[model samples]
Target: MRSVLDRGLALYRQGEDLPAEELAKCTALAVQLAERGERIAPLLHAWDVGCSVAVAACWVSARPGEQSELVSLTQWSSVGVKEITAAISLAYVHAQKQAGLDTSRRVLADLMLNGSATDELAAAAHHSPAKEYVAVAGRVVGENVPSAATVARASAALTTGDLGLSCQAGRHLCILAPIRSHRSTEELSGHMVETLKRVGITFAAPAGAVIAPRSELAMAVQQASRIESLAGIAGLDGKTVESSQVISELAISRDGEYRRQLISLIDPIVEAPELLKTLRTLYLMDLDRSRTARRLNVARRTLTYRLERIEQLTGINPVRTRGILAFVLALAARDLDLSSSVPEGV
Candidate 1:
């Protein structure tokens, strides 16, 4: 089998033609391994090692000082490695079917990794690649990490009809659900939080966003993960936030220069702790002057005076519509650690 792989690789290097028989043998080997309950990772690793050896030998056996031939070998071997891996994947899927094993997990993994797989396999898994999905991800904090059964039970409890697949990787749990089924991502997020709480697991700061399509579940998961991180930075723990609500803040959270520039909006009054507190409280109170004043233990008139002073110092009103947006973003950027010491009197 190893010799077969080497021969196929060499033939490809020499003539850019992959031998059909060699690929068939690889497929057969993968099927056999799958049927025997052997993992595909080790088999793939062995194939990788075999490819490395063949490539090295080909390079060494090149004619003396044959730089062009060596370069060609490198390129061809790279292509061979990918083709062989794909072949193995298809073969393993075939083996799973022949053995009457559930291939849904494998199908999901393939989609997550490559964003696409054979349409037939996807159909078998009931995960149509053409459909759109919403990805909800949350960080599982504390020692009581939910077990696989716990995760499944919680997911089943929260979702109905077509339940999307849930993947738990270490401290992170991501679920990709059909968009049509779950119209409101926030509702889905709330369901997740509630169900997780019932399982003795604290789902901290779950975040969600609509992804492009079922094939892009991985990207959606990544987006949800980023949202969760941003929520944490903003001290929004135990809250379920949709990306759309904080899209601008999320964008600013990514760029250091933008964060610094936005945070600088409040630099003029950073030294005045009282004014800063007032501004933060105003926003937190949803710009309700009466509530903000009560929270700050100040009279409404005092709160009014602080807002005027804030506008005078920073040139941006903390209560007006446009000014409110800018100040909120600046506060978010600062909370995300874009802090700098503005001179005391600036």
Candidate 2:
């Protein structure tokens, strides 16, 4: 919430209009709060505080002999703040009517993913068959997981042109967004992260592949989910992992024998907990020796010794290109059993 306020203030300081995207984010947060049994008072209170802070910002930035314009500035700020507050209040009321649920969006998401969306539902949800789209799959973490409807509403607010659809399928949150540009997936995912943060919801989803046709959405979602799991195994959390970032590990994760062989490459270092930690930290830090040593809270000399020990045990240098890739893939393959991966048309 503080971050949201700060972001709003930053935009104001820069003399920029509050984009529709930011307003949509506010609506999403209002829905979440109202769903959680919060009243409109807190939302208004936050807005009031924002108005005060924004006024203070204006005062500080006022030029010499501009005292006469302060009244004009205050009036303008008051109007803008009131409008934003009213919009958020209306969103709260709307959410209350649905008991803070987006049941329709959830149903629509399920139907689309299963290829069962009726023409009516597709039309209502604004899903276009001829449009290009992308799937972002994730698992909600932390104490407060936003409902699928809330996610869909938030995604829709951030989406341009036709709105996107989202739903929670078992443990995964699947969002289908129309591709507005090459960076549509990246921008939407980033907005989701920011909006959800205001209400304390986070996703452990990575970037998903683009879907040229609506028919492949389900498969792309499933594949994204699998990549998400792969990222988890590599100790990557939040939205930090991209599909492209883990392509190599994903490629070798399927073969049972090959996976075991890769895991074995690190098995020797695994027996020594310190050495294993060092190796993992090294990779996590992108093989930066100085940073890795500082993260491990060890002297550079000690860090070097651990790297040497890992090489002695695994017969692979940890610093070189081939060696680093091998170790990273090995670590990713560990505990990644995809035998029960999502089946087609599921």
Candidate 3:
């Protein structure tokens, strides 16, 4: 959240409207936040603070001759202020929760996103949730995320037909759904899938775990994320992925030596977000250039340009079978290394 605030501040300081993609990310954050939290006053406050600071930035970025108009002393009219403030408020609200439980969610999100716990904060939230629950780690993405109220309605089946708490975990929405001890993993996965489908929310197949005690939430969440490597079990993308299946990918992902090597190899392309996304989609489309281009809605020439640039940057010809395998492995490593990586200072 602080990072999001900083980004808003930087954009505001530049006197630029928030980019549509960035706004969307913030909006998605808000939707997931809505899953467990109920209010967003703090987020609002943070945004307001960013806006206020951005206004002051005019004093610094403005040239001597342009100072009067940009600064406007007392400002005859509140011209751009209202629009900027509204944008900040709305976008921040989209990423915010209802009101309380901010700290609890923050701690949990940090642990899930980074894969380590903040002892003091985690301890406080630890005792609060159910003791025997299942952890579901996966993401829900798109322009129109379901409303918080709508998501709450869906949590019924997710929380073991009882209650569950879904919170933000980096790029994923990790839910700790409470379940009866007797419930089997198959029954649990079925319940989760049915609930999400009913809500009209299409999500990546989740990595799930039947958590024994509430205190081990951090570990459960980590295991859940790693389970995503179990691609064989996933009949489709938007289904639940269980831990019992991810033997190979999980094993390879755990090797720190290989992970770093892949990171180094992939970093050249991954460093460029657009290229990385293109490469990922291409890999998903089974290295079919025409299909990938169509999916990306780009012309064949443009796709070629991007792919050639990627090969140049990564020094690996993605057109080859070996190169394609490398691309796939690199992406998996990145998912494990950067996205849901071990927590900083862990």
Which structure among the candidates has the greatest lDDT?
Answer: 1
Q: Count backbone overlaps in model 1.
A: 0
Model 1, position 38, has a per-residue lDDT of 55
Show where candidate 3 strays beyond 4 Å. 1-188, 195-222, 225-236, 244-249, 270-274, 305-309, 340-346
TM-score of each candidate?
Answer: 0.64, 0.60, 0.40
Stretches of model 2 off by over 4 angstroms after superposition: 1-102, 126-130, 143-161, 181-184, 195-200, 205-212, 237-242, 335-346
Ranking by TM-score: 1, 2, 3
Compared with the true structure, all predictions reach lDDT values of 0.67, 0.65, 0.57
- Residue-pair clashes per candidate: 0, 0, 8
Better of 1 and 2 by TM-score: 1
Across residues 1-346, which tens digit of lDDT does each residue of candidate 3 receive? Answer: 4455456545655666556676556556656655555444455446546655655665677786876665553242143333433444343333442444234443343333332323343344442444466777665646134344434444433444343556554445566666655777657756665677676755654545546456676667766755643442323343566655554456556688987887687787766887888888887788788999999999989889998998898889887888887877777776666454333321
Q: Tell me the spans in candidate 1 whose CA falls farther than 4 Å from its real position.
A: 1-7, 11-111, 116-130, 141-160, 169-171, 180-202, 233-240, 338-346
Q: lDDT tens digits, residues 52-125, model 2?
A: 88678768988998677677667766776666665665566567557934344444565566554455555544
Model 3 residue 195 distance off true place after TM-score fit, in angstroms: 4.4
Task: Give the best candidate by TM-score.
Answer: 1
- Superposed Cα deviation of residue 10, candidate 3 (Å): 63
